[model samples]
Target: MSDALVILGAAGIVIPVFARFRITPVIGFILVGLLVGPYGLGRMVYNHEWLTWVTITDPERLAPFAEFGIVLLLFTIGLELSFNRLWTMRKLVFGLGALELLVISTLLGASLSMLGQYWTGALGLGLALALSSTALVLPIAGTHTPVGRAALSMLLFEDIAIVPIIFILGALAPYADAEGLDGLFDTLWLGAVVVIGMMVIGRFALPRLFAQAAQTKSPELFLAASLLVVIGASLATGVVGLSPIVGALVAGLLIAETEYHSEVEGIMEPFKGLALGIFLITVGMGIDLTMIWANLGTITAAVVGVLLLKAVVTGVLLRLMGARRSTATETGILMASPSETTLIVLAAATDALLIQPGTAQFWQIVTAIGLTITPLLAMLGRNLGRRVEPVPEIEEPESGEPPVIIVGCGRVGRLVAQMLTRHGKPYIAVDSDADMIETCKREGYRAVFGNAARMDALDKLGVDRAPAVILTMDEPVLAQRITRKLRAAYPHLPIIARARDSLHAAELYRAGASTAVPETLESSLQLSEAVLVDLGVPMGPVIASIHEKRDEYRERIREGGALEHKPKLRTSTAESAAVQAG
Candidate 1:
């Protein structure tokens, strides 16, 4: 068979599944690269020989495309970053990041340096350990809350820090080389100039470029513009002596400022998904199961020790920075995985010959093994959440009767809570949005910021003690989720949910909410008819008219069957019967 066809066949087979396996393709690609190269099924395309060879023989030819994948990945990262968000996240990103970087690096570096590894090696180890896997964590984060934002920002800070670490590693090259300092300085200076220069350029020029592109209102052109910005920034970063990932990140940040940020992200998502698929698969394929088994004891010990250290350190930092205990713990768990980017740095160092190839390979293999252990650690965090008692307690004011606990503090939730409050009924509000929680608190109301889905948050809000739950979030799906969680945890707890319409309310009721108020339709209609009757309209006719209307809607929605364990209403109103059927 011809060499060209062989490589083309391999590329076709591999690239198609790249998106399917997600980040695992990076591992697949590496393994496939190894297999196709001299190591596995040695189909040596060129014997260190031909110029025009397709795959292995054409390293220079393949380099740009491989580099493009990295560029795309960074660009996605940059696009997600927002300066306003970062400003709000100063504590988590800067304060927690610094504490994590300094403490983890110092402790690990000190331990390794004491054990006779090169000080530089120890420093690198520390840095790598301090950095959590963005690929691993971000997907888990997806689009949650303050936690997701915090995780992303911390990852950003770590990615940015890599530029300087590259220079440091570069500096550690043989001192005997007279030009070593000059080389390090040049790299550092080049990186600074490029990053700062790009920020200036991105702030000024890129927005206009994106605006011009967006003016066409073509998804294709918008996609093209996003691609151009990402690739251009990435190439620029590469030119200025940094990884293409940095350029991609810078590109993302710049584009995030554009009017078309969401549109751009939507357009670029497929590319990001493709790149990430390859990245994850590559990670999975590089499992190094044998090495992982060999160092099982050390890896296990290191994982535990590092996790403990991180949890304690992160928790302390969070508490010190005024974060709630639950927030701090969630942060620790999310940040536990040692980042894949660390391996990238290790690879770069090896490529530059600043560190032995073995050093990079060892950490890479260790990291791969470490990734395997993350799920277990996350589980442990879940099971062992809030093990230590909170120092400054945030308990609700004790009441005689069980309080109506609202799971969200949005407009609807606040209104419901205020209604209850005005009636001299006790209630507590919980929301994941920090600003919403703050606003609720300032209004002289009881509210806590937390994830309603999480047990810790529910527990904090005295869910165990509460007799009822109010799901007042605008999103009916979210309301249903909160209802289900509350029902499962407290089966007897009556759940009243606000739904957009009767259909949504019915769905919520089926999802275990005792009563779902479709404000726009059923509830409003019932209340309006009652108010009209009170204003001396014919009461008997109005009551009979609405009663019939309510029954039909009830019958249509009640097919899901009885979800009630216990009766929620004492009065046999038509709404009560419908809720019971639900």
Candidate 2:
């Protein structure tokens, strides 16, 4: 209970405090763990008994929760991916991901062997260090951009390879028998069966299960059902001698296929975040400051050696695989660190007697340091990538027409695109929704998949070259943010945004949107126009009066927002008027 209190208190303090400084909360959690864990303040408790109340006396008790945090992380990753999307990246997953793991492990192992370790011990170390931190890397890179996609492909392959890597470590044990290999073969078949069974049964069962939960209109019950599925799936895989995360991932994939995935994702997000914090905290607790200080020279050399080897190997492979230089460089750096899973592999190596306990402890400390600095590595990679290629090398449109860029592909965005098409104006749409992008493509619209919330995606779309940009997503905050970024980057580029109401319109205008079209105002104007036309007003005069009212409301909104200048009208609107006049 004291331990739980300590963790909760740390989260309460760490998250907001770090966020205020615009820093990642990950560093804060790790720092809190370092401060409060048994090796830190807990060390003073023997002399100062009162310290026991505040510091974590039992780090072991938090292990299960921390592991569950990883499980939830995998679960969410599964939710973000569908079977089709996974299949689409099969070449990157199996080819690049496989080669990356094997090459890095082999090179590192050979180096360790030359340094006087036995081949078995070196191999164990090599494999352990080859893995990258999916838990840390994915959230930072996201699964959207070229860098994120590349990272996700490699990480997904690594996750899938964990069981096999462990099996190999056990097989390499000096006293290992045929029984261990037999068990592995049994696990392989059993895992396969379990996965297929879950897919078949989950497809039939999950929708009905969630439907029953949704009918209750109870958030608590919904959460209970979500947890049950994740736990049950995780246990199934664990029982079959596979990783519990496999089960969690399968559970998430199943839920994702159902209509309730979004709701499930939304409800489960807070739990996933808290659990992940516990995992990060546990990582911090593992760092033995005294041990690190004593072996600082050897540990530093090992960390730097592993980081460089992994980064170089991964980057070259990505380049050969046809990734852009910037993407390859960024992804290589981002994935250079050893993973949270590396610690697990280290534990396995120690248990199998492949590596000494002392050696495992040394490397575990190194892994912790690697995890702690992942965010810094990411920032470094991003800046370096920008320096390497100031502008992303995006492919130009085939038509040779300068396309108007649409930042969303939703209903309003689609309507805007239709009008552009009707006027023979070239345009392209970008959206974060994969399904929406596919739909747009099938309907003969030029669409790209990307998260417009990030400027990288916009830059890749050649936003600077585009004649105009439109923001049509319903998210007010996101729209405003993108508008601010676009305005700052391209001061003269016209930005038209959809607003929920007059207030939202004002906010978007203040955020640098050239024009903010409020749905409420448009609906009101349409209603007034209909009433006048039905009462026998001439159609031409009614249409002119509607446009006049819209302009009037737009002026009022801009004035209310305290804007000093009335921005020029959109170029597209002027062009349309010119064509009509001609």
Candidate 3:
């Protein structure tokens, strides 16, 4: 109970404090672990009894929970991906990812052998260091951008290869045993059978199970079912001598194929986060500061050497595979560090007698340090990528018309693009939806697929050079966020945003939107105009009155948003004037 209090306290302090300063909570949690782990405050608890209340007296007890955190992390990652997306990335996963692991492992292993270690031990070390942290890297890069996609491909392959790697390590054990190879083959066959069975059964069973849970109309039951599925899948794989995370990931993929995925994801989000935090904390607890201090020079050299080699190798492979130089550089650097799985492989090597316990401990410390610096490495990679590729190439329309950027390719955005076309203005639409992009392309519309919420995507779309940006997505919060981000980044860029209502319009105005067109306001004005026209009012007078009313309402909205009215000439104003004159 005291330990639980300590963990909760750490979370309460770490999340808000780090978030307030715009820092990642990963670092904060790790720092908290270092502070309260047995080697830190717990070290003094024996002499000072009061310290026992705050410190984690037995870090080993937290291991199960930490492992579960990793399971949940993989599960959530699976939820974000579909089978088609995975299949599309097969080349990257198998070709680039496989080559990267093999090359790094071979190079690191040969280097270790040259330094006088046994061939088996060196091989174990090489394979262990070749792995990169899926937990740390994925959340930071996300599976959206070029860097993120490249990283995910490699990480996915790594996850798949982990079982084989462990079995190979066992085969390398000094013990004279043909059964080791036999066991490896047996496990592989069993794992394959189990995985296929789960896929076939889960495809048919999951939707019905979730439906029953949904029918209960109980969130607690839904959550319970989600947990049950994750746990059951994890246990099934673990029982079959495969990585439990493999099962968790498969379960997530299965759930993702169903309609309840979003709800399942939402309900499991908090648990996943807390579990990942626990995993990170365990990583920190493993760090023995005194040991690191004693072996500082050697550990630093090893970490640097490993990072440099992995980064260069991974970057070259990506470049060879036809990735952008910037993407290659960023992904390589982002994936340079050894993974959380490095600890697992190291422990496995030690258990198999392929490496000594002391050696395993040393490498574990290095892995912890590497994980701690992952976020910093990510920031560096991003900055370097920006420097390398200062200006992104923009895809322009064939007509060479001035580019008007439409952030969504939805109904409103399509109408806006059509109007722009009629006015002889060239426009490009960007949407996150692949289907929408495909439809737009089929209709001969210049549309690109990307999440505009990300600044990098906007930059790639030439947002800086565009005449104006139109936010047509129905998400009010997202629209406002994009408006604020764009306004801050490009102070002079005109931002026109769609709002749900007058109140939302006012909010958008405050968020720096140049114009916030509220659907409710426009629909009301159209209705009023129609009623007046049907009641026998002159067309010219009614049109003029409607224009006058729209302007009045816009000014009022601007006032409500606490902004001074700034009159600006608009194309609509000129059209209204022409109508009034006629």
Tell me, by lDDT, which candidate is best: 3
Worst 10 residues of 3 by lDDT: 566-575
Candidate 2 C-alpha RMSD relative to the actual structure = 8.9
Candidate 2, residues 315-426, lDDT tens digits: the string is 9999999998889999999999999999999999999999989889889999999999999999988778767755423344467778999988988888999999898788
Identify the runs in model 1 with alpha carbons over 4 angstroms from their true place: 1-77, 87-95, 142-153, 175-178, 305-311, 348-359, 389-415, 426-582
Better of 1 and 3 by TM-score: 3
CA lDDT, every model vs. true structure: 0.66, 0.88, 0.89
Report the C-alpha lDDT of model 1 over 1-582, residue by residue, as the tens digit: 333453445555666786575433334444554444332233343454442243343233444444565566656665676767657777666766766678777887787689777877777777777778766666555434555665666676787677677666656655425464576678677878988998887788977887788788787887777778777877787786676777777778777887778888777777665555445434544555556678778767766666677667766766777766656677777677677677767765665565667667667766765565565555555345445423233456566887878878888887888799788788888888765776577567788778887878788767888878888788766777777877787788887877787678678877787787667765566677768767887755665666666665666556542443322222224445455766
Count of clashing pairs, candidate 2: 0
Better of 2 and 3 by TM-score: 3
Candidate 1 lands at a TM-score of 0.62
As for model 3, its CA RMSD to the true structure in angstroms is: 9.0
Residue 41 lDDT (model 3): 87
lDDT of 1: 0.66
For candidate 2, the per-residue lDDT at 322 reads: 94
Give the top-scoring candidate (TM-score).
Answer: 3
Across residues 511-536, which tens digit of lDDT does each residue of candidate 3 receive?
99998878877777778877887899
